[model samples]
Target: MCWEAGLSTEAGNSVDPRSNGLFGVYVHWPFCAAKCPYCDFNSHVHRGPFDEAGFVAAYAAELVHFAQKVPGRTVQSIFFGGGTPSLMDPRSVGAILEAIGRHWTIDARVEITLEANPTSVEADRFRGYRAAGVNRVSLGVQSLREGPLAELGRRHTVDEAVAAVRLAQSIFPRTSFDLIYARPRQTLDDWQDELTEALWMAQGHLSLYQLTIEMGTRYYDLFRAGKLQMPGEDLSADFYELTQELTQNAGLPAYEISNHARPGQESRHNLIYWRYGEYVGVGPGAHGRLLINNQRHATAAEKLPFDWQRKVLARGHGMVTDDVLTWEEEGDEMLVMGLRLREGIDPRRFQRISGRAISERQIAELKAIGFLETLPNGFLRVTDKGWPVLDAVVADLAA
Candidate 1:
């Protein structure tokens, strides 16, 4: 029940944190102005007055707590993810970043990013965030159409979203926004026109996600009641194929399954994750993959905001789970995460982690079926044809 409990490093003490590879930090801000019908992220709408100053202190303490566990690692990226991190005061963000710098040797070119929802008021805070040392912003501009925007429970209008994007572009050195496709009754042509406009507004990166009805969300309830109709499987596949073709032609290729970006503009923070890099997750419902003593450990924090804050203040950290991962888990994780990237997984690293060779028989089956391709450098990647059924590919390989 004590999420902030620490793992003893008695066996891990001989391991060098730096040698463990890419390090990043993830900070979760659990408060949001409203919860969308489709979102399953650990975000809540708190009606009472939020204690920004207290939360800032708790975040700083949590950072120090993790710093002690894994010392001497240079942080290459920091991501402030939601429940709508934009809800936080700019000063709160600054305090947390300052705490990180004090704990670790921050890479000179460290990519600091914050996730924001496009609203006029949040737009006004873009400058404050940049001044707070955030160099990048990812906007939640889910749609450019008013109907879909409302259906998605977004408070911002099309014009407001555009204005926010423009404001972000002007204030930050790097910016990206998200779009959701394959919505209920979203026609191919409707998406095409919208995507075109989105590309025009995009700077160099875009997070394009297919709408999925997650269990326990309002969407799921509506879907079960037959009120929400999703795109059919075949239609969704067509949408995926069209998205790849269009984004590739536009010169912002699909760097990851759902994220498209111009070369060199990929989200470094997200890359740290897909590349199986180590990162510390702070705040409620945050999850982390870290090197404790040389073993890769999986960590997750308490999910509720007040509970996490209270635990951190009392116990110095908010980690609920800190289990060391088995080689098989690491290998499977690498395959699932890395194959999401266009560059694919490094077989040598997989072997090193899993302590076994990939089944040549499985590879041959996938290759023969035209679902996978082997790079000249020996990495195994999913072909464009393989992306639609990526889950199957990863499962077959990881099996």
Candidate 2:
């Protein structure tokens, strides 16, 4: 199909589609040295040695399996995310990249990112990762304060986190770090001070997240038992406002709800997800969206590390759930994901995919309530007031 930049002929038609559509790969590493109390992600801590070479082989096989299904699609980005991707040996990383190169055509400017924790031991391997085709690194520096770091069950100290950032900046072409704010006993002034320091240390991007006590996490138990207190709604709103103001002034604006980056420096891998582009996720507990036979399919792999590996070894892939989404499902997902970005969703594109347009009355009502705005580019985005209640806003529009 002949096409212009940033406009797809149909949903899920192109491989490596840039602005209009994109194809990427997400590799999940589900093992960690220790699991954090608040983390609900599929990660495991093993006391004894495990088979690294065997795992790498399984990954290569899985790649070949997905490649057969998604043939001829050029890869635009490759992300190594996990329980700490930095824990993998550089040689393992190199082998995985080699397998990917063999399976599909990779863009010359493809953004390859590896998620790392900021321990000195991990930082020492930064050079090796850069050499093994990781051009970008996102460090999990949850806090810059010792007390909070400990409370978050992070192993690294503040100094180690800073050093790791500096080291990553020196080794990788791009670097981004995460910080969790709105913790118990956290004052606005406290966050301001921490964010100021973080901005000073930041090179290209920052991900600032509010602490949410999710179900099944340790924090959930604490909150239910009256042992933990979070910031009230009003104070949380203040914190959000402060964050936006600080980041905007610092030249790193909120590109997404929890992510801030300089113009032209946004995470391309994540943009694929938010834009509802096609991607294949490999490894335990990984979820993916891909178009097969002109239908969008949602896929998820087994959550247990060993079981996933065994399944992949026996069969070609470890996918446990593969469901074709309905049109309504597509519309709801497009709104839920795209509205998180500052660029917002294209209404015409949504109409094309969903076979329906957003209600003008609802749009006008949302704008009147100060919860939504019409962008100059003709895209509709949630306003500052809307972001805090993003779920409700998206639900109303989806309804």
Candidate 3:
């Protein structure tokens, strides 16, 4: 079904961008120089030539297509995420930004961000990207150690990663980099030393993720073959607890489970997702949540890069999935995303979305078990004790 948000005096048609809460845009660039063994993101190694101009035009058309569906809102954030957005030409990025500005009333303080992988060549382009209006940059500096970098199939060395981070910090007003701990052979002492160094390099924000073995990745194949060994339950928990302690003491607290940031430095684009706000996802394999006729519709695009570009050029969009979420699905999703945040979820908003009240019996059980708590302002949050088993808590509550 087509989701059309016409300009009418409807409840969702709020002109003030902040009036309707946060609105954002996500652009996915689907090419990468090389594929990592542990990566499961929709990325590909495209050989031969890439038509940057054609892809840029397709992106612009896709933006206009979504603009028609959802209008009269200010864009608070725009994120270029992907295989490796740093591989993109700066002019192409600027063109996409121009198209967004053309379609939406961009907020004066819009947080425009691009995700990059740390390489010497990509580092050289940092200034060019900043000039293209990308004010924030997140580097895929997965590790600071030489061994981890090679084991993870990263092309950049430790020195290169550091140089890239330093360059990105000097160029972008807001900069953050990622680190993956709990690797196949990573020890507690190893992670501690690496994360401490990371904390020193980090300016304001850091995306610290625990290594998970997802199906279909090379890591998973090796793990099944008994070649890749991961941390056990007790060791994994130790690593996590140590991470929380170190980052907390360093003054960058965990605002979200996998992300730590200084106060006021949280990624606004990511918050649009965790806070359940509306955004448009453009390009290959990008997923989005949008308000269509006051209902939340989940959308996704074609996965292959060339195929997505072809579809966008032919039909003005590449969306292959658009499902209007049911109340139960919305509630489950709210719990899944919102409970990851330290500030937690508002029960009132949950009620409004799901049209049902949270079970008081369930809440009491969780609270008694020291897994959950209610804030003085009536927000229900997962306590630190509950966080290690967050999925189970969310499942119990959703049930």
Candidate 4:
């Protein structure tokens, strides 16, 4: 299949069928200084020295491999996420970006973001990264309070986070930071104060995530043992509502349930995910979503560093799973992701990808339950009332 722009096609067919014009690239760095107890993101602590040069060479080769697989697709965004991407040497980042530029045609306005922990060591390298083609930085300043920082196992102090943000603002054109709300023993008033402080410090974008105890996390174990004491459901709901109200009043409305941005400042790379666009994931434990010849496919990379390195060096790739999504599965995914956004999902696009529309019966049921509102633009968006009970709404749709 040949896309517009005279790009040629390969022999194999796409795994799943979907057509969304945009595409992105995501590079996951699986090494962190230390793994947070609540993190289960395939990240491991780098206790000893590792081969940075070898890793860079492997990543370059991986990019070449992907370029061959999906030729002629213009890259709109590139995100370096993970075990603290800021830990990467600026030169390595530069080399990877150079390799990407050589392999694929990138959009001139492409948003290349790197996630960093708000430590002085990382902050000092902000300028070096900017010079290396990283235009955006998402600082992992999970909280600005000392107690919460300690609880979350963050290395940086509140002062360090503030300083890092200040440095990031000076260095990068686009800067965003994340905060984890609804912590154990956190009150609504406490969160309100924290959010206010964060908004004052924020340059543009903010990702306020509620702490959830996922299976395999330390928090989950603690909860199972009845040792965890996070905010109760009622308190969590209060925090969530306060977040929506506060961010809206600040003119940084919630574009997604957990993400807030001033108009036109939303994270473009994230938008690729929420909008169901194609993205390539590289490095250990990373996942990629791709569309080729109108077929959609998902890629999961090897979970361990040594394993991923070996696979990349041997087969020129580190992919563990490259499964194609089914139409119903794709529809369900779209519903799950799109509904997270304030604008919701486009009915036409949903039908195009899912092979069926969201049933009117389901829609009526959701509206009757005060969970959704049909917009004039033909999108069914989740109402504020619906957000607090998002899981129930999703279950209703699935049923």
Leading candidate by lDDT: 3
Residues forming the 10-long window of minimal summed lDDT in candidate 4: 1-10
Model 2, C-alpha of 277: deviation from truth (Å) = 0.7
Show pairs that collide, candidate 3: none
Which residue window of length 10 is worst by lDDT in model 1?
1-10
lDDT digits (tens) for residues 56-125 of candidate 3: 9999999989999988767888999999888899888889988987887777677889999887346547
| Whole-model Cα lDDT of every candidate shown, in order | 0.88, 0.88, 0.88, 0.85
Q: In candidate 4, what are the lDDT values of residues 1-399, reduced to their tens digit?
A: 101122223222233445566778899888888879888788888787788989989889888888888877777789999988898998888888888877777776788899999763454477788878888899999998998899888998989889888889888889999999888888888999999999998878999999999999888899999998888888888889999999999989999989999988999999989888888888898898887656678899999988999999999999989998897888888888888999988888888887887788998988997899989998888999999888778777755
Off by over 4 Å in 3: 1-20, 120-124
Question: What lDDT would candidate 3 get against the real structure?
Answer: 0.88
Candidate 1 Cα misplacement greater than 4 A, ranges: 1-20, 120-124
Clashes of each: 2, 2, 0, 2
lDDT of 4 at 135: 83
- Angstrom error of the Cα, residue 273, model 1: value is 0.6
lDDT of 1 at 273: 91
Q: List TM-scores for all candidates, in order.
A: 0.95, 0.95, 0.95, 0.94
